[model samples]
Target: MSRGTRAPRAVRAAAVALALAAGTVVAAPPAGACACGGLVDGPAYDTSVSSETAVLQWDGTTQTVLLELDALSNAPEVGLILPTPAPAEVALADPEVFRELDALTAPRAVVSDHRWWPELGFGSGSDGAGGAAGVAVLGEVRLGPLDVTTLGASDAGSLGAWLTERGFQLPETIQTALAPYVQDGWSFVAARLAPEEAATFDGTLQPLRVTFPSSSLVYPMRMSAVADDTQSTRTYVLADHRVDRVDPTAEAYEPTVRFAGRVDPATVESAELAALLRAGGFVTSHEQVFTEPGTEIVSDFVFAPAAADVAYTPTYSVVADRRIGPFFAGPVLAFAGVLALAVLVIWSGRRRRAPAPTLAPRPAGA
Candidate 1:
């Protein structure tokens, strides 16, 4: 669900890229306020491929980003990118964490009335390798086949030129797609496969976990326009408060939210995550899925955590404007109550309308 996100131009929410086709462009980046650059191959790489799905977990101080990307093409090299609000500490994360989280936060199906006659069943469910002339180094590390480099650049033009100069191939559209970020002055990361590990990649990329200091949980997605394919992401926010979308003023911004109840203490695996959930009953979960249409991508998923002093008040899942319950009976019961009240009102009105019985017979007798 999380793609917080980058480009062939950057390693955004994890935006690394590789060549898709001879004419394709690629980019990597995930940040706020902009400032990006790249070579001509930059745009082609950025546009070539899209991450099918991602899982994001944020507990205020730490953000764990995990993604499942298709296995790489049999190319000589593949590039990865990640962009963050602050310098990030990254390492390989367990892929199982994502599978567990996905199952944990999926939208629940409700069967309000289970009739005895039938049994109904329902179910649901980067780094960098940055190198260039005039590029200021930020950080660099290697995880698996990726050689990561993080850096800062003055503008997209220079960043573009640098990426091209550093032996990174560029697509024709790289410049136009990356202008805004370069203008916004954001930092980027570049990741490439180690030569020895290149051809042997099994198509399935291992999930990577990145943690950085951000005032709140925010996923940078401004550079997604470089890709020609549809983009989709699911974000799981584990904090006291609910999570939502940023830059609401944008006409096309919309995402669905679900309150994935408190983590049962017995079920949690990570001691640290469990401790965070155990300390306060206020600890709860929220998930938002962005099904962004294949248009110019905008907005970032913004998650706001619960205050340390407050406790959680449960709210059901939201799809569009509808709210599904903590256990699925809430709305059903409310509707039944409304129906009962309407029936009572109609009965009372009927009784009142019946004219009082006349005493005409008694009066005649008198």
Candidate 2:
């Protein structure tokens, strides 16, 4: 999804014309590692996916996936190919849902005063598818500025050829990457921005929600191996209990849990998002960088409930002040007090050795 593949010349020309007519300025794609659920093709502008975020909510029988992509492109048209285990119902997700979740899970900041008699020091830290023989078009719908198409294919080759025929420009590596999903009998979801929508795209794409029947909580990621470089992914999962990432292939790499706890229903502003959270009170946030997707990510990310539903909140401490009033604390204060005592003792010793300032002073007084 982050890799940039050029569209056919015809598609490019059409996109250019659209941009010109819309009075939109066309620019070269910005540089960044691209990551996507499937393959990405841009008509007039080069596209790169910088990062991806997904929120997965699973009940016992169904799963709802909401995804947002941060990408840069000047194309008047952009397309994405996503593979899923079952047919999906695709629609626009409230972008505010992500914002609300972020606010809810953000790391708690703890500030402490470092009274440095001198002070204390501290540290802290912190799809779609279709086409070709054996490819069947399942459904298509338009939501806002997006055109979404769902397709099923018997094999990966047919699916790849079909997309290429439709100007997706699939590379051999990407085609190879699709084999496993096809072999598993998965369906594909293809989404594209309408010309009007693409013209208005700024680096951020509107979030999309896909709901389908799934027995296990999963985030499709195998196809992401086609990305040109490392990919960074952030995933939020809502379930009955805390969940941990499981790589079916048993790879050594796994996403780190950033936050895990039960979310209060009142904090969720979106009625739709809130309903999903109500089914599963706990949320687990995970983050990982796929350094070598080709080898490291041999399978999609699967998640299972952890043994315990323990809550986790990442917190850090900050020193607010080094001095309180005119007194220093900590090591500095101890050292100053010791020095002051030492000087007093030395002065007392010298006075005692001076023979009481001599009798001369007494004679003068007499």
Candidate 3:
């Protein structure tokens, strides 16, 4: 009992208009090269002298990072290595580069993630009043208050161990404890007491705050998922190059994406889904379609280009109950068809009655 293909002509016209608008061409980025910096370091554990901050390098740029470890007092060893097996279509994997990352952090905690904020004209707390905006990291951790300046190797190790241990537990259990409280792109400072520290009398220990550098780059992307009649969407945006925000709730979604190459129009599936949307009683202000064209940017790969931009004022309404106006011509066409049939029947009858005699008289006069 599905009423299909009933979208008004106006709706189809609006969709076409959107397609025309997005038709404007755009410049494409170099293909197959990570236009955005790729990963340089890893999932490896750092075991060496711990210091204030560690530095990791990628693309000749150093990223200062910090780790919250386990054990308040143990043989002070801190290691910071970038995780490995980089994403496909990008070449960021270099074990040697990660080793160099380890060498740099032995003397310091990687503070790059926390320190780079000021350069964007966003000033940190140290700057006097009326300074640029600043974001705090490891400020007040669940373990306790953390200080970024004085955080040492021992503190980093304690925090790391605590997180690692929790991760090792049952996956579901781990998620249960953290899922409700965790936010993507969120950084936290965590620590655990060493065996000796654990042996001490039960008491709360002070948390250490740490400072790390942050990148200015932010990329946000949107993707949708549908199951049966219900639909869901998720967005991934780089909070900084190092941090990403993932929002599951259907809220605002806009990601400042790095302008990669334009994809081909052929790659875009079809407007059928969009048509289905209209039939399902959803109205967008505009509709457009795109396709992927043939161009070898890489081996067996091509990007899908946008066909056009859609300008739409959203209107969500029920379609089943909409009333057709009297001025609508559909009913008029049905009425006219009936009237024409009646007129043809009447005219045929009159012609049959008079035609035979008229034909005989005309023949005689001739």
Per-model TM-score on C-alpha atoms = 0.59, 0.72, 0.21
What is each predicted model's overall lDDT from 0 to 1? Answer: 0.45, 0.62, 0.20
Regions of model 1 farther than 4 Å from truth: 1-64, 71-75, 109-133, 249-251, 270-296, 305-366
**What TM-score should be assigned to candidate 1?**
0.59
Which regions in candidate 3 have their CA more than 4 angstroms from the true location? 1-137, 141-157, 160-213, 218-335, 351-366
lDDT tens per residue, model 2, 6-123 = 3322222111111000001111122211333443444335555544556787776777777655555444344556777787787777767767888888888888655454324796
lDDT of 3 by residue, 57-158 (tens): 121121211111111111121111111111111111212221332232122222232221112356660111121122122222122211111111223233
Summed backbone clashes in each candidate are: 77, 19, 69
Error of 1 at 254 (Å): 2.5
On TM-score, the leading prediction is: 2
Worst 10 residues of 3 by lDDT: 13-22
- If both were scored by lDDT, which would come out higher, candidate 2 or candidate 3? 2
Task: In angstroms, give how far residue 6 of model 3 lies from its true place.
Answer: 48
Question: What value of lDDT does candidate 3 attain over all alpha carbons?
Answer: 0.20
Off by over 4 Å in 2: 1-36, 42-45, 74-76, 112-131, 196-205, 249-251, 322-366
TM-score of 2: 0.72
lDDT of 1 by residue, 276-345 (tens): 4454323333323233322545544454543333323333443332234533454566777999999999
After TM-score superposition, the amount by which residue 321's alpha carbon in candidate 2 deviates from its true location, in angstroms, is: 3.7
